[model samples]
Target: MKTSLKRFFAGVAAAAMAVGGLALGATSAQAAGPVASTQTGSLTVKAANGTTGHTLKAYLVAAYNSDYQAASDGSLNFDTFKYVVTKDNGTKSNDESAVKAALTDAGVKASASGSASSAAEEGLRQLTGQSAGTPFGYTDGTATASAAERKFADALAKKLTATDSTKWTPSNVQDLTPGDGKFTADLNPEGLYLVVDTYAQKDGSKSTQSVPMLVGTKFANAAITTQPAGVGEVDMKNVTVPVHKEVVTDNTGKAANNTPSYNIGDTVYFHLSTTIPDYSGYAADPTLSDPTGKTIRQLNLDDEFEAGKFTGTKVVSVKDATTAIGDQQGVLENGKDYDVTGEDTDTVTVDLKRLVNGADGAKTGWKTGDVIDVIVSGVLSADATTTDKANTDAADKTGADSNGNSNKVTLNYSNNPKDNSQQNKVPGDTVNVYSFNLNVHKVNQDNNPLGGAEFKIVDKADEATPLQFTVSGSTYTHAKKDTDGAIETLKSGADGSIAVKGLKAGTYVVTETKAPAGFFQGALPSYTVTIAEHYTNDKTNTTRTSTKSGDDWLDTLTYSNTPDNYGLVTKDATSPSTWTVKNVKSITQLPKTGAAGIAFFSVIGVAVVALAALFAVRARKASRLA
Candidate 1:
């Protein structure tokens, strides 16, 4: 699709109207009357892709002149291919002066002094690249419309839709249904018709709609040479607006992750994205005072998160990327360009229709294919649960039973170009923020529960500093450093279990700072717990250019104790694996007062008596000499 308004509808209209010999054959001759009822042909708008569930409506823009001659080789030859003003099947009006003037204004050529039929033929010839006094390319059946032909077709379709749209009524509607994987409309008066599709939104709707196309049924029976081919049939190209949800890791909005992990009490950045739909045939509504003919009724992005796991949802920014040539972005204003309802709640809805249609005095000139991004921030709750296994399906919303905290985004946009009131809902892939928990158990050599053990946890990256936590009796909750009411020690309960929750993906060291009263305090048991989640991007290109990529989050757990040899100390088979720490008794208590003590006292008394006698004799000898 072209980014500019002038070339926006060029390819779409050209592809739709450029039959490439895909028109129907007229079996009957033209009737001699103002309206040729015999020239009617059965036209089928076959969805080559076999897509169902769309309403195809055709409006007769003009009536073809009855001047074609059937050739011998099953083809119609015409020196002049022209469409004249006739009563529209919709409004029953024949005032085609406005239509001709619109064609002329769009650079289509028509005769000023010729008959109305001749002037209409000349304009159509210029639009279809068919020249007067030349046979239409039906004999060889290898003719294709050129780029110039397509450009003019787009202009003609747009003008007719904008200037004379009221001419279409209920009589020209066709409910395209399942008929051998194709839809064939009933035989009607053959002429130049504008085809537009509409889909009704329902529960679990896969509403795929078709772009506006122009089909000429007057030249029927030309077999289609495209991939989807049939007699008098044109392929209906359907489009589905896509929506994506990702984790924004940086400010550039280019770095995104589908598989992400975060710690509890940490703020997670979320990004919701989708491109603008093609709005070629949509006309301005006079009721809304809309000047741009590309106004849509609604374009919304509703983001839903696990309410129990996420809190304080904040919309950071909403940007319209690549507003124009050389312009990188156009930041939309809150409550104006887009209104965010249910902000700070579990579900945040961003309404982008105002910016899409330039409603309420907002700036216009935003083109199709523009990327709309809604960036939001939310804090992971301290009560978030750890996932035992990674979620393989990104579309699954069962976060509580399957994986981690899930953030999902759903896009709702106008499905019907003619009627903007109807909308289709498309849910994007869900991205998750994961965290893990570590369970520690204190026990004796017998593997019995031993209580009163205090422990602390520190990240391996910075083992010098212990992670802070808020202690409540025996329970410990993860907290930030210097946080109010944060403590350094987490005491074990009577069950000898200490649960440390909301841990990020990294190696952590859990050491027992205070052992039980009588347990050996020498070399308190310490275990290293590593929680890592690895992701592999399936993209072949290492440079990371496109957004269409996939990855899988491989969650892993590793644990090891400080001492190489420990009695009955092991990890249990459980999610958030439990490490049972064992303690031994101190060898200090022995007999205090017994028979051994009495014997020791007797020996000491005898040695003291001998020493005293020797001292007395030495003192008497010294006195005599003096």
Candidate 2:
């Protein structure tokens, strides 16, 4: 009975071993099967306005059991899946937004909350195919997923949504959140399309699409505006041309008669006549106005004309037998003589009537038809006689007569045989009578007078001798000297100088009308000075003790001390010991002299010289005595 029981148990044990081997074989086969790949999708986006394009792809895999997780099993159960969206011209935001929108429109239920791997898987599943269980096999599932993904992509491309496109203004699309599966607004549509990539546990996938957005419209019309034309106006008026006139002389001391010429001493008048145009009235009468506008109607020309004068005269005589007159005499032209009795004709009778007619000297003074009368007079050499015998006898009585005849005749005529030509009258040459005009205008305008500002006459010593300047009128002023020996309108202060403020740049004569008490007015130097710009303190103070007429005037004053002690003295050699005139004079005379040790040393040399001289004298006497 025991042996039988052992056989049965052994058989049972062997059967158990066979069953375990079969189970081990089954597990190995499952591990060795084809790996199941988790699918992923990628998104790509493109921008129109200088932006890049993007693309997205979907990767699908067949479902597998969890036992196929090992490599030997050839099954892949993805713990983490990655979906990459690349932007050509667009940013990651744009790619993400485009992908989310694509999935949402395709009826994909994207979870608002999930891990990156779970979200990626969910998004891929939605893009591939609807969650409906379709029984076709692994290939069928892949085809369905691909078709669905393609449809989703096609829908996204049809809208032409791109970054930087005006039409791509999506609502609630500002920032993209990871794993949220929502659209982002950070899109730029400048260039290229969007690219989407997906990574699965066992495989990778991708998709691409082109974005069409209006980029050229942003800068379609750009140009600058045109400007308007311009015109200019100018004035047309008379431009005055200057006329210059000068006097020229001939060899003879007298002015040449060619022109209405006059010697330097001759009374000559200047007459200017403009053709009155019959419209504009003749210029007001000619008058001489001084620089101060003082007019003189009858100014004596003699005062200014002294150089030209006839110093002396000589007489000449002519005598001949043919002419009844025995002798003829007249004033002789300088350096010239005439022979009356020689072959040149001692007597030639001048036809006055013919001379006047041929000479054309009738016209005179402004009127084209007026006639001029000429007069000639001179000392005669002898008395005249009608009979030729008597004329000859008179010519002989006077030595001025030729042929020793006393009958010499002096001739005078109204009409001479000279002086008629256009060249006779020159501009500025005074005729017997004419009309002219004169006009004078002030160039500088008047300025408002400022009071308290002093006017001074400065000399070379820079002495500020106060003078009064009166604002007589707008343009004129009178600077009169006062009884105090100083001028009025000038301010003299304790500083021993005058201060002229607000005075225009010009020349002024500063005079001292009143010297300080006990000071001799005339004894003080007066200066004739000029107040130059930028020279004085701009106030123009003459700083000398004298009047404007003194010689020791200075244009500028160097106080030597500070302005506070300007007129003060530190020492006094003469009376009134406390800072007296002596001290001021000494300081002014020798600027280097002072109470310092250097001044004391200056006298030491004189003392030493005197002592040496005394010793030399003593030595000389001793030598002589010895």
Top TM-score prediction, candidate number: 1
Error of 1 at 95 (Å): 12
What TM-score number comes out for model 1? 0.68
Q: Number of clashes in every candidate structure?
A: 6, 106
Minimal lDDT window, size 10, model 1: 133-142
**Best-fitting candidate, measured by lDDT?**
1
TM-scores of all models? Answer: 0.68, 0.14
Candidate 2, poorest ten consecutive residues by summed lDDT: 228-237
Q: Give a tens-digit lDDT track for model 1, residues 1-626.
A: 21221122222122223323322221122112234333665566666544556667665555555564444544444322334445545344433554455456546666644445435434554454332111111111111222333334444444545645533232334443447656666545556555667566655554456655555553543432231122245556444666776676754456765456677778888777787765443433323454442344567889998877878887888887767422335887886677888877899899876666656755566766678877888888877766545555654232222456777788887766555656678777665677777788878767789899888889889999998877676667677775689888888889888877777777788888888998767546566776656654433312134663322243443444443122324676664357887776742221123432344455567779989999999999999999
Rate residue 240 of model 2 by lDDT: 13
List model 2 lDDT by residue over 415-472, tens digit each: 1001111010111111111011111111101211112222234423434554233332
| Cα RMSDs, all models | 10.1, 48.9
Write down the TM-score for model 2.
0.14
Error of 2 at 318 (Å): 61
lDDT of each: 0.58, 0.22
